[model samples]
Target: MLTIWSGLAVGAIYVLVAIGFNIMFVASDTFNFAQPQYLMLGTFVSYTIVVSLGLPLVVALVVGGVVGFAVGVLEDWIAIRPLSGTGVHGELVTTVGWSVIMQGCVLLLWGSAPHRVPGAGSDSVLTLLGGRLSVNDVVLIALAVGLSFGTHYWFTHSKLGIAGLAASEDRQAAMIRGINVNRLSTGACAVAGALLGSLGAVVGPKTFAVFTLGSILVLKAFVALAVGGFGSFKGALIGGFAVGVVEALVGRYLGTEFANLAVFGVLIGVLLLRPQGLFGQRRERVV
Candidate 1:
């Protein structure tokens, strides 16, 4: 049970990261390899506000989100917009370069050491279903579930969200229909950055602020995205939780070293069985 709770907390973070990836991919039809850096920067920003500046958690989150949003917009303008209409490989290389630059900046500013921040919730523990869990864990679980469901509903029902989806499905058609593709793309990046920033504050206590954190997170999040099916919001949530739970179980029973092996083994197996992923739809060739 403790393992389950811990896995859920980690899964929540993965879900947020995956969602950010999905948002960016849908809006721009390109993956932002630098997305994980936003998460890293958000954590450091929150630490600066809440720990160094001695501000309230809410303030830290808000500031972090704003900074993240600005960075996201900057990325779209500098890295994405200029490379638009180019092949995916170019964008991928550009984004990866940007991610490396951000990592360097973080190392220079924050140094090589990891910094810890206060938890989002109290240290108190509660028992549920014979499992003892911390308040922070509960909060993480709640936020993960809530945000996942909320995003799904918003995409399905909200006008702007639906427009974003339409734009993603057919950017040319959306443009002909009077939708501003550029604006949508920028807005999607901003939204993704904000979500990642706020999530950093929420999960800071579990994972310390560190420069190298982004690399690990981005890899895990990508795994979740691939497993859940790219572009499927619900799949991100499901894939994240599945990865987290499986990793936790493997680490507990087998060994820490075997955990990653098992996770990737599962991914390989899944890909072999269903290349499109669990919820991902395979695109059919019109030809």
Candidate 2:
């Protein structure tokens, strides 16, 4: 039971990362590899505000969000916009390089040590249905799940969402129809940035603020994204929880070393069975 809760907590983080990837992908047909780093930056910023400056956590959230938004704008202007061309997905050279650069900057700014951030609500452990879980775990799980469904609903129902869908499918046609694709793209990045920034409050408590957090979380989130299917919010939820549970169960029964192995094993199995992922659209190319 404890293990399951642990998995859910960790998986919630993955879901957040996957959503960030999805937002960028939907907007620009590109995954900001630096997206994960953006969340990592949030954690450090929150840490600085909460610990170094002795400011309230709320202040940290707002500041981190602004910083993240600014960074997202810069990312679009510098790393993504300049290299716009055909076959860009397989060749996101600048974004990948930017991730490395962000990591280096983080190391220089925060050092290589991990810092603990305080959790909200309560510090006591609560037992639910024979499972022991922390307040932060419950908070993260509930928040991630709600956001996933909320996003799914919004994208499926709202006019703006429908427009985003149209834009994602065919930007040129959408532009011809007056969709303002560039604004959509920037808006997606900005929204994702704000979310990650606010999420740092809970995330820092669970994972600790560290320079390598982005790299680690991004890889696992990619696994979730692959398993759940690209462009599907429900997929992100299911895939994230699934990956987390599998990793936890494996670590508990097998060993810590085999946990990652088991998670990747699931990814391979899913792709082998359904290449487009469980919910992704099927595309056919003509030769």
Candidate 3:
């Protein structure tokens, strides 16, 4: 029972990261390898606001999100925009270079040590279904689930969200139809950054503000994305929880070392069996 709760808590973080991936992919059809840097920036920004300045948690989160949003826009402008339509696959390298650069900047600003950020909620533990969980855990889970579903609803119902989707599906067609693809792409990055920032604030208590947090979380989130089927929002939710639960159980029963093995084992198996992933469709190319 404790294991399940723990898995859910961690899984919530993965879900948030995966959603960030989904947003950028949907908008630009380009994976931002530097996406996880937003999470790292958020954690550090929140720590500066809430701990160094002694501000309220809400204010810290807002500031962190704004900073992240700005960085996202900057990323789109500097790293993504000029490379657009170049068909040179330079984005792959550029995004990775940007990620490395962010890491270096963070190390210089925050140092290599991890900093603790206090949780917003009560410290008391709650017993649910015979499982021990804290208020922070509950809040994290709720926020993650709410954001995931809320995003799905937004994409389904909102005009701008729908337009974003249309733009992703066919950028040329969307442009012909008077949709501003560039604006949508930038908006998508901003939204993703905001989400990651707020998520970093919420999960800081558990993971602490560390320069390396982004790398670890992003790797697992990518596993979730691959397992769930890229571009499928619902799949991200399911895959994240699934990876978390399976990892927890494996670690508990087998060993910590085996946990990663099992996770990657599942990934390899899935790829071999269904190359498109669980919810992904195989795209056919004409020769």
Candidate 4:
């Protein structure tokens, strides 16, 4: 039971991280490598607001989200937008550079130490269905599942979402149809950043706010994206949950090191078998 609940918690975090990656990458066709940094930034901001400045949790969360949103827009303008071309080379280089800069900034501000988040509702462990789990774990899992659908709806139903979808299919056609590609791209980035930052703010206190947090999370998210589909919402959710469950089960049976290796290997095999991903649309080749 403990294993099951714990596995669910782990899966939730992966889902959150992977969703952000899917949204940002699919909308703009650019890899926002700095996304993890934004997550860490959100965590750090919340830590500063709540722990250091003695602000309320609500306030800290708001500030953290706002900060993350701004960072996302800035990244799109500076690193991603500039590189909008035939391929993602420009965005890739710029994001790598931005990641370095953000890391450096984090180091300068927070140093190399890990910060803790204060307890939310309750830290008490609850037993359910013969399994012990913390309240935070329950909340995190619920949030992840809820947000998965929420984000899917946001992208598919909303006006902005339709515009984003149009842009994703073809930038030229989207533009010709009066879709503002730039705004859609920027909005997508902002949304991704806010979601990631909010996830960090909620999860960071429990996890640690460290320098390598961004890199590690981003790597995990990248794996999820590949496993799911680079641009598929359902793919990210499914891939992330599977990765988490596999990691947990593997770690329990084997060692932690083998878990990552096993998942990556599976990802490679899956991609080889189905390149379009589990639910991804088939890519049409241009002559």
Deviation from native of the Cα of residue 4 in model 2, angstroms: 0.9
Task: Find the candidate with the highest TM-score and give its number.
Answer: 1
Error of 2 at 178 (Å): 1.3
Model 4 spans > 4 angstroms off: 86-88
- Pull out the clashing pairs in model 4: none
Worst 10 residues of 3 by lDDT: 276-285
Query: How many residue pairs clash in each candidate at the backbone level?
Result: 0, 0, 0, 0
Report the poorest 10 consecutive residues by lDDT, candidate 1. Answer: 82-91
lDDT of 1 at 115: 92
lDDT of each: 0.84, 0.85, 0.84, 0.79
Candidate 1: tens digits of C-alpha lDDT, residues 33-127: 88988889988988888899999999978887898899888888888878765445487888898899889999999898999977656478899
lDDT of 2 by residue, 1-287 (tens): 88988898889999988988887776667777888888899999989999999999889888988988888777777777666435455426788888898889999988999999876763778899789888888999998899888888878889888888888777788989988877787777777777887778778988899999998998899999999999888899989999999999999999999999999999999999998888888857478
**Cα error of candidate 4 at position 263, Å:** 1.6
Q: What is the TM-score of each predicted model, taking all chains together? A: 0.96, 0.95, 0.95, 0.94
> What would the per-residue lDDT of candidate 4 be over residues 98-200, giving only the tens digit for each residue?
9899989999999999988764753788999999888878887888778878878877898877677778778888889998888878988898888777767
Where does model 1 exceed 4 Å of error? Answer: 87-89
What count of clashes does model 4 give? 0
